[model samples]
Target: MRETLLLLGARRLQVPAIHVARKMGIRVVAIDPSPDAPGLALADCGYVYDLADKKQCLDIAERERVNGVMTLAADFPTPMAAFIAQQLKLPGISPRTALLSTNKRHMRAALSDANVPCPISISARSLDEAIHAMKSIGGPVIFKPAVSQGGRGITRLEPEESLNSIKSAYEHASNATRGDGILVEEFVDGPEYSVEALTWDGLTTVVAVTEKLTSGYPHYVEIGHSQPPTCSTYDVEQLSRTASSGVAALGIDWSASHSEIRLTCMGPRVMEIGARLGGGYINTHLVPLSTNVDIVGAAIEIALGRKPKIEISLKNKAAAIRFLVAKPGIIQSISGIEDVKNLTSFNDIDIFVNPGDRVLPLSDADGRLGYVICTGENSKSAIEAAETAKSLISIKTV
Candidate 1:
C-alpha cells in the first residue's frame, strides 16, 4: 500500500508535484478552494477546501490517514503544511519556521541575526512609521507586502518620489497580507538569482541556481529564468553557500526552499526566502533538465519522512524558460505556436488565452500570456533556444 500525502493547493503549480508524487507511487490527496483545481483531477483523491482553514483540511487529512502533508510553489500553504505535520507528529519544519519564512520582517531579522547578508528592511503599518523608516534607510526603497507570492504587491519608490505615496502602498500591502503590514527595504541593485534547495534531517543541499529575468522598476514581474548561469565556479559556490546559510538561519528542514538573492557589487544579499518549491515551473521543468534531479519526487519523500537521494545525474547541460509577451488589450489573435513546437530543444509552451481574452498590464506573473521551455548543452544555448522559440509566437492585441 502506498503512503498517502495530503497536498495543499491543487492548482497548476502543484499539478507537477502531483504527477511526480504519483509517479513515485505516492497516493496524492489534494485540497483547494476551487473544486476545479487541475491537480485535483490528477490526484488519487481530493477535497474542495481552502488551504488556510487548517482545521477543515486537517479533518480530511485525518480521514485519509495521510503519511505526510506538503505544497508546491505556494507560500500561505507552507505554514499550513507544517501545522498538519506537527499535529500528526510527523517529520517537518516547525510552525514557527514556516511562519517566519513567509513574513518578510521576521525572515530578515533572522537572517541578520545569523549574519546572513540581506537588505536593510523595516516593517511598518502606518505612513508615520514608514516615514521614520525612510528617514533611517533613505530613499529609492522597495515596498513589499509582508507576506505575498508570485510578484504581488511589490513596488519601487525612488528617492525623489513622494513619501506620501507609501500610504497607498501600505494599504495595498495590508490588504494583500494574511494579517500583516508592509516592509520598506533599501533597494539592492544587482543581478537577481533564485536558488533551489532541499533540506532533509537538518541538512540542506543546494540543487540548482537560476538567473532571473524581470521587468525592472516598480512591479518586477519575472519574465524568464536560465539555469547554469554564466558565472565562475567560485561565485556559484558563494551563491549556494549564501542560500544554504539562509536556509539554516531560518531553521528550514524537511522541506524544499526557494531563496531569492541579489548579487550586488558588495556581495550576495538575500531578498527573501520561500519555504516551498520555486514557482514558474523552475523545479518541474528547469531543474530536471539542467541538473537531472527529480526534486519534486524528493520533496514528496521529505514530506513522507524519508531522506531523498540528491545526485547530479546530468552535468553541464542547461535549461531555460522564457515567457510569451503581449500588450494590454483585447487579443485579436494568436499565431506561430505550432511552428515553434517544431524547433529543436523546444520542450513546452502554454498560451493562457484565446482570441477574445483581454491581456492586462504586467502587474504580476499572471499577466504573462504563456511561456516556452527549452534545454541545451549550455546556458547560453538553452536560453537562445527558449527565446528563439518564443520569438516565433505572435499575440496581436488591440
Candidate 2:
C-alpha cells in the first residue's frame, strides 16, 4: 500500500486529511509529540516525535519510506515538511520559502521587494528597536512575534498606550522563539479576509474567499468566518489577484496556500500566508459545503506529484463557523448542543471538551473548545443561523 507521512497529527485539521487519505487507499503514518492525540488512534501507524524537531521527523520519514510527507494548518510544521520533502526529492516548497511564509518579517520584506501590497513592517530585536520602529512607522501599530502563529504573541498598540506592553509582548515572543526576534508593522484598518488557493507550475488558482469577523475592540480573537464574502465583486477580485501575486512572489511552484489579507481604503494588503490548509474547519466543512470543493483530496494529489483537481461546483451559498470559548478555569458542564444540532440550518456541531476538561480564555485559536457550522443560501441567513447556534450553546466553568 502507498504510505503518507502526516506531521502534527494532533490537530483537528489533520483529521480530514487522514480520513481522505484512508478513503483513497493510502496508509497514514501519523507523527506527533502528543501520544494521546485523538488522531493517532485512527492512523495506521503512530509515532511520537516533536514536529519541530526536524531531524527526528526526517529520520522517521526516511525509515518508513513514505511516498509523501505533509502538514496542514500549522505554520511551524511547514518548514519541517519542506526540509523533509527537499531531502527526499518530493513535492514541497523550498525551505527558504517556507521560512519566509512562517516569519511575518521575512514575508513582508519579500512582498515589499516584489512590489506586492503588504503592510509596512519592521523587525525589532529589542524593546528600544520596537519603540523606534513604532515611532518611525507612526502610531496604531501591531506588534507580533516573528514566527508565532494563531495570534499568540500579537498586540495592537495605539499611539497613547505606554511602551510597557511592548516589553510584555517581547517577553511572550522571546518565550516562544527559537532564535528569530519580534516583528512590528503598521496596523491596517480594514475588513480581514482569508483567501484559499492551490498552485501548479507557479500558477495560483483561487479556491474561495472567507469573510473573517473578529472580536472587535481590545481582543482581536477570530469570532467567526464565512464563505462567499459579503464584499463587492470588485473587492473580491482585487483580493484574489493580490493573494495570487503574494503566493507567486513567494516562489512556490506547486503547493496549497491559505493567505490572510485586509481590504483597506488604500487597497488590499497581504497579512500572512501559510503553505497549507486554512485552520478552523475552513477546508473540511466550509469549503466543501459552500463551494462543493474537495480540498483535502486535492492536497493529497498535489503531494503525490499530480495536478490538483480544482473546481467550484457550488455557488450562491454561505457557510459559517463560530467557536465556543469559555472563561479561564475548569469546564463544569456544557448545555444546549443537542438543541442547536436540531436546528434546520445548523449542519454540524462539535464539542471538543469534556465536562471536567479545563478551559482557557479566548486569546488565540488554541483556546477554542468546540465549534458550530451553519449554512444558508445567503450571507445574512448564514450569519443568523450561526448566531442562533452560538446562543443555543452555553459553556459553564468553575
* Strongest candidate by lDDT: 1
Cα TM-score per model: 0.97, 0.95
What is the TM-score of candidate 2?
0.95
The TM-score leader among the candidates is: 1
**Residue 378 lDDT (model 1):** 93
Q: lDDT per residue, candidate 2, 249-283, as tens digits?
A: 88766788998999999999998888888887888
Tell me the tens digit of each residue's lDDT in model 1 across 257-375: 99999999999999889889899989998998888999899888999999999897656579999998899999999999998889888898998889989999887788888899988
Residue 142 of model 2, lDDT score: 81
Give the residue spans of candidate 2 off by over 4 A: 1-8, 356-358
**Model 2: colliding residue pairs:** none
Q: State the local distance difference test value for candidate 1.
A: 0.88
Any idea how many clashes model 1 has?
A: 0
lDDT of 2: 0.82
